[model samples]
Target: MKGLTLDAALARLLIVVLMALTLLPFLSMFSAALAPSGSYPPGLAWPADPQWANFAKAFEVAKMDELLLSSLLIVVGTVPLSVLFATMAGYGLAKFDKGRGRWFYLVFVLGLTLPFEAVITPLYYEIKALGLLNTRFAIILPLIGLYMPFGVYWMRTHFVNTPKELSEAAQIDGASEWKQFWLVHVPLARPAIMSLAILQFLWTWNQFLLPVVLVQDPLQRTMAGALGAFQGQWGTDIPLLCAGALLILAPTIAIFLIFQRQFVAALLQGAVKG
Candidate 1:
């Protein structure tokens, strides 16, 4: 009991330290964002007069309305389709015969090793050939393909670990393969799917490299992707830059907060099973 008590106390202390470490930068950024537009606030020092207008200024200067809409469109286009394809592919890989599925699974696993930087040059040429450069499709199509390996891998792990008995029972009840997948497997895979959606949403929203390279218009790029131009224009304006940075980060933070329970549950579910 004494040892456990000591361990608990140590853990609590470590948590507090970690929390402070994590929050310190955000506190500093918030302070910087509130400082006078031209002035640099040192460390976490609070500005005498908080420049709340900086956020509005940042929004206007960065053209956040356009950026936000573009980001939303890209995410809507990319995440759902990626999830649907990944789920189907994962299920196929998990349930199908080892003879054919293993080779296909290995192909996707190979995809996991192919980093964006490795094929980005050819990808640019390919998009140019398709006349997709400078359009939303350029970013959307590449992202869906880029995200496939991990998405399929994540869903496969969940489906593979799910008990075969459930499928057998469903089959005995006269459920077709399609019915079994949609009715029995999908419901059980909800947590995993939700977690995968969250991750893909974040990745699609924050995607910078592909958007920057593929799309010419800043308005068509992801919010974070547009930040490069925003930064280039307002780089010297520390407060506005900080505000823009915060705005770029806000959606992802909100998403994680809203779905934190589902996310944590999915991750823990996998960990526990493993």
Candidate 2:
């Protein structure tokens, strides 16, 4: 009884500490964003009147609709490419044995550890050389490449979990390789693919440095880039920045919340099977 009581107390204390740490900045930001705009609040007190319209003002000034559309386009293009490439690569790696498999596997795994910063310089030149700079495709193409190794690894793991017998059975039938991949494999991979898509989408949506470095045209840039530009232009207003952040964060947050149950289940299922 004594030990159980102590453990409960510790758990409660840890939770309190964590909640405080997590909520403090947000609470401060909320208060600051609302507290009449001139100075910080007197203490930990929230704003007497939270100016919700600050958000609208931010939207008006920032051309948020355009920013969001740009982000949407990048995400739309990148997600499918990443998934298709990764899935095909992963499936091939898992299913097909060319005997040089170990070398390819090592190289693919090595890609996960390669830092984006290290490749940025070379990537910039490559994009520029291809005459793709200031275009969204420049960012999209690199993202797909960067996503490929991990995507392949993720799908490959899932594919391995799927018994070899499934594919062999399909092959023993008259089904072509493409048909088997599309019909038999793709359906089974829904969970693994969904999990990877959510992860990749969030990463791509929030991507900053790559877009910042590669994109020179403001309208062509993503929401993250636009936010950076927003800061440069109207940073004196904290409320506006917060408001813009809220707008920027809204769609992904809403999507995650809507699919929270599925996301959790998919992650757990993939972990268990893979």
Across 16-61, the per-residue lDDT of candidate 2 in tens digits comes to 9999998797776666666565454554577778887877787888
Q: Let me know the TM-score candidate 2 reaches against the reference structure.
A: 0.89
lDDT of 1 by residue, 1-274 (tens): 3656887989988999999999899889999999999887787899999999999999998989999999999999999999999999999899973998989998998999998899789999999999999999999999999999988888888899989999999999999999999999999998889988988898899898998999889999999999998988999999999999999999999998998998788678667753
lDDT of 2 at 98: 64
The models' CA-based lDDT, in order, is 0.91, 0.83
Candidate 1: residue 46 Cα off by (Å): 0.6
Clash pairs (backbone) in predicted model 2:
none
| Predicted model with the maximum lDDT | 1
Please identify model 2 stretches exceeding 4 Å from their true place. Answer: 1-20, 38-44, 269-274
Model 1 TM-score? 0.94
Candidate 1, residue 237: how far the Cα is off, in Å: 0.5
In candidate 2 the C-alpha lDDT for residue 221 amounts to 77
Candidate 1: deviation at residue 143, Å? 0.8
